[model samples]
Target: MMELFFKDFIMLWSTIDPVGTLALFTGLTARLSKSQKRKVALKATTYAFVILLSALVLGQIILKAMSIQLISLQLAGGIILFLFGLQMIFSDPEEGTGSREPGHQLAVFPLAVPSIASPGAIMAVIVLTDNNMKTFTQQAMTAGAMTSVLLITCGLMLIADRIFRVIGHNGSAIIIRVMGMILAALSVELVMTALGVQRWMS
Candidate 1:
């Protein structure tokens, strides 16, 4: 049981990828003020928590009703992440401030969905909490592990916000472009893995 708990923690940590999410958060919230960035981080984390918890509890049923496979979700999410990555890469880091939506809306988008509570994270929770495979206690332990990871993710985002606060716009611009490339590569990996093309190619 203890070993399983440890495994779950590591699994969730990889799927959640708090550092990756932190990069996305920093890049997305670059235009906002310090206080706004804080609120966005908190809100994105809260939203991710709610989303992952819901997936743990009810995702299987919902997916079944929609006749959707986890791989399909992964494919779709990968496409979206790739597009967002391209946007982050090409668009001016300091542009879009005046015409764009508010910070709270950003908390719901690429930040919350594919960034923090990613498709991999969602699939992981659902699989970990499968009604047939796991007992209630085991599922509960998995949930606890996921929660711990999310807390860590949130902490990292907060710390990143502080770092960016010091570094200012120029530093933020460079990292955002770098993270965009990373995100694009990540999305491609997600797609290939979902398609089971990895073993075929390499």
Candidate 2:
């Protein structure tokens, strides 16, 4: 049981990649004043937590009613993850920010939507909430862990000034590319699993 939960935790963490995305998100929000930065981080992460937990609690029924299977979800999520990974790998680091107005908000759209509460994370959480796989208590624990991870990510971004000074743009690029590779690989694996190749191998 412990081993199973541990595996799930690691898989969740990798799919989410909160730490890696934190660097990018912080860079995008870099121009905001310190207080504004903190506010955005807190608001965005709080929103992410609520959405994720809601998904975890109700995702199975919702997906079933929509006639969606976990395998199909996995495959779809993998494609999205791969596309995002490609963008991260090949695009300019500055591209995420685009053109910014003086009062542009960072907490709502890209930062919270695709960055933290990513499509992949959404699908992954939904699948992970399978009632057949574990007890409700275990699922709750998993949700808590995910929330904790997001909070930590927000904290890291809140201190983005000092963090960026240490790692710089080059370091950030390296991390993004590395995360992209991992995401691409996971995407492929999800496809294969959905195709039932893993069952054959077993």
Best candidate according to TM-score: 1
lDDT of 2 by residue, 134-155 (tens): 7887787678667767877777
lDDT of each: 0.86, 0.70
- Count backbone clashes in candidate 1: 0
lDDT of 1 by residue, 21-116 (tens): 877777777778777778888898999999999999999989999999979989998999899889878988656567454587778887888888
Clashing pairs in 1: none
**Superposed model 2: Cα runs more than 4 Å off:** 1-5, 71-105, 164-202
Lowest lDDT block of 10, candidate 2? 96-105
